[model samples]
Target: MKLPRSIRVIERGWLSANNIVLEERSEAVVVDSGYVAHAPQTLALLERALAGKKLARLVNTHCHSDHMGGNAAIQKKFGCAISIPQGEAPAIDNWDEQQLILAVADQRAQAFSYDDTFRDGDVLQMGGLDWQVIAAPGHDTHAVMFHSPEARVLISGDALWENGFGVVFPQLFGRETALAETRATLEAVGRLDVDVVIPGHGPPFGDAGAALERAFHRLEGYEQDIARLARHCAKVMLSFSLLEKRSMPLAELPAYVARVPILAELNSRYLRMTHAAMAEWLVNELERAGAAGRREGLLLARGE
Candidate 1:
């Protein structure tokens, strides 16, 4: 969906994030090329917008597989210089596939090279405009937001959203301060004159203040949920056993909580977290929240 003036939003569904195509002086720059599946469409959108003009630069908010999945593709197609967030540089430089890959285990992410780095307060001249870099790191430590202060526009990369924000899986990898950091990050983003917000996920919003407010509230609930689940005993084993039995059929409602790695490891140690445990916990959680009903050894999720 093309926005007014120089910004266009190219939706990539699940693989790549929605591409933000910025235009300037008939030349162009694309923000967040998205996943590998999105490279062709991203390139196509850029070609259509630029009409064969040079794609001046390729910038990433961070180096997640979803956001930078098309980085190599765009670099190959346009021969553009790729600049990502500074925190993302080392991770991308080494390319730990599992670390880079979205929702995956241990597989090292394929290594890709970036030409430069983006830091907070940096200005990127694109689409006949200058976009100021706004580093916000609730989702990924390295993630950065782009702002067109003149337009009161912000491209928030998984930091702020209409309803909620990204998961805090990185904390499991030893970053204890991640949640605290996320809270502080939100504080910074709230200070911006963001009349419009284009998040890494979901539709763009005109009232970013309202969006941020909703996200903040959701974050409180989400954090409480995560913490609550973490403290429970045998939760991981229960989740796994239940998921393994009925996971194939119930794809939409994820039975497994991948972010809770500690619980996953615990499942391996104590086999008490059995199928029955999972079934009980799931049913109990649902029952507690009034979102599910138990009937004949089966639990049904609530209909919206």
Candidate 2:
């Protein structure tokens, strides 16, 4: 059934993402405009929700392309001032393709002018209520979560969810300590006295406490794998040594011998080590163990 147009959810389904619209008086404030593919639908939603009113402000939790995809479309249409978290001003301002999350496709995005900066403890008044800015890392290192205390609502950007957190690929992209910082942020979020959680991906969860508990429990198990990786860093170190002898791109290596997931996951966790360092660990560990061999610039496995 079609939900009432009030504060309608623009569920762009997949390619576009979702957007949250706030209607105040005749005016509106749209948050996280999804993607360019979803721009038309977002505008249509705004048209009905605004009811002849204009969009006063456009804001984003962080600068992920998907979150800010419709920025230009909205800006051109309503000419509203755009605001984002202070942590990601530069990337958001320039729309730097490399740093706007792990965008698999190499594509530049439409530019949007930045008007304001948000930080932790700051309140963004939307819909006649103050939405507090809460730092939420892990998914995007500079991401921020929005909280509206009066409504007990939280706009959790890829941080806490009904199941678990997003991929900790920020390290591969450049952000260090992404997982650690995210864990700390999630723990803090779990403690908040709230009733609903509107995450970046899942449906709005009414039982915030129970959802938070499940998220934390998932964190615990993930942490154990992280610890095991740290203790077994020598394994990856040895593997890279084999690859070094060949000279292949990282992606060409065999599954069992390649440092695709394991080492990448470790590097993402440490957040402190560079890809070069992480590569060194994998090569050294696997090469010496004879598990991997360097062949024609490619890292391959001796068996399986």
TM-score of each: 0.75, 0.69
Encode model 2's per-residue lDDT on 1-304: one tens digit a residue. 1222345555543334467777777777878876665678777877776778888998887776567878889888888988888988887666666676423332234777788898988998876678889888776778888887677778786777667655554335465586688778888787676777766665666777777778777666656676543535435333323322334455543332334444455555653466665555565556676776666656665531
Q: What is the Cα-based lDDT of residue 250 in candidate 2?
A: 53
List, residue by residue over 1-304, the lDDT tens digit for candidate 1: 2244888777555335778888776577888877555567767876776677788788888877668877887888889888888887777767765456433431112346888887988998867777899777766777888888887888887787776665554335555566666787788878888778887767787877677688677667646665442323333233323322332223322344323344443343433355445445555765575555555546554432
Clashing pairs in 1: 16-35, 23-127, 24-127, 24-128, 96-109, 97-108, 97-109, 98-107, 238-278
Number of backbone clashes in candidate 2: 23
In angstroms, give how far residue 220 of model 2 lies from its true place: 2.7
Instruction: Return the TM-score for candidate 1, rounded to 2 decimals.
Output: 0.75
- Runs with alpha carbons beyond 4 Å of true place in candidate 1: 1-4, 101-110, 228-304
